[model samples]
Target: MITDDTTVNGVRIGGAEAGSDQGARTIELPSGARAEVRKGYGRDLMRAQRATAGGDANAVVFALIAEVTRVDGRKIVYEDVLEMDLADVMALQAEVIDENFDRPPQRASQASSNQDSQSRS
Candidate 1:
């Protein structure tokens, strides 16, 4: 269960979900509903993969929401997410992508070093 101050992957998650801000871990919809999102792990990804076996991009997003998020601190299923309003659904999707896929920017020096190393190999 995620609380107001839960930290996932060393990033503290709190407040309403915002765009490109890594500190938010909660999704707030225009309808006043809220969901607490947790950082996804391998098992969660496996579950999402199984739920979205048809290769549907939208289904994959909903499946991940089902496997990794909680509404009012209770676990929700894929059907629940599907039943939500499009705005809410999209908000959840954005949060899920941020939680699972967003990465910190690589330093320019590191990028250059990697490129140099690759060229030498």
Candidate 2:
């Protein structure tokens, strides 16, 4: 089942031309690096959770990103992400959030309010 268009270096490619992999997406970083990110499995999430236990929110984000992202065909570890530029980290953060977090629907109050600029007491 190895096709020239799909296999590279004995590994199968998994995006766009390959028909897309479920729970996986590619992210282009601000630093000009391309990363393949996949939804974290339960074990991946647990690993991040354990590593970030008692740490700040940012620590959790960093750990999760490290656990799920592969940049330029290389697996980046937590320390690698820690050393990345702030902008790149933020870009990855946005992608990770987009992939893993579900956005709630717009609130009715926000959708309906403030149309006339009249302040109600």
Candidate 3:
């Protein structure tokens, strides 16, 4: 859902409410249940996560923390912060397109197998 206005760490955050990332992940399976790996950094990653919490958190907590820690000598601007969101949306769209409509590989492989079988016969 989209949020018209919200505050986080005092800055007004607009655009979409930063939704939590969720997806299937793989692990050691005991039986028939399928799984996938939803990638994330370890708890040492909380500072990075604050960026997604929106508003000043991106620059205040995440950006500043990284700068102070000397992770990088850079400042996260407003557009840069928003690009993170835009990037994710594009990534999600690619995955959805691949899952739903990308069948060229499968079709080509199957066709190759059929040609091989016909030649052998």
RMSD of each: 9.3, 7.7, 15.1
Best by lDDT: 2
Clashing pairs in 3: 25-35, 25-36, 25-37, 26-36, 26-37
Cα lDDT tens digits for candidate 1, 6-89: 766654456422232343377677778878777776666766888889988778878988877777766788999989898888
Better of 2 and 3 by TM-score: 2
Q: Who wins the TM-score comparison?
A: 2
Q: Clash number for every model?
A: 0, 0, 5
Off by over 4 Å in 3: 1-17, 24-105
Task: Kindly report which residue stretches of model 1 are placed more than 4 angstroms away from their true locations once superposed.
Answer: 1-24, 99-102, 106-121
Q: Quote model 2's TM-score.
A: 0.65
Candidate 2 lDDT over residue span 37-117, tens digit each: 877665567668789888677888899899888889887888999999999998899888765656788676863577534
**Per-residue C-alpha lDDT of model 3 across residues 30-87, encoded as one tens digit per residue:** 3322223233223324545555466544344333222112102233332443444444
User: Each prediction's Cα lDDT score?
Assistant: 0.74, 0.75, 0.37
TM-score of each: 0.62, 0.65, 0.20
Model 2 steric clash pairs: none
Root mean square deviation (Cα) for candidate 1? 9.3
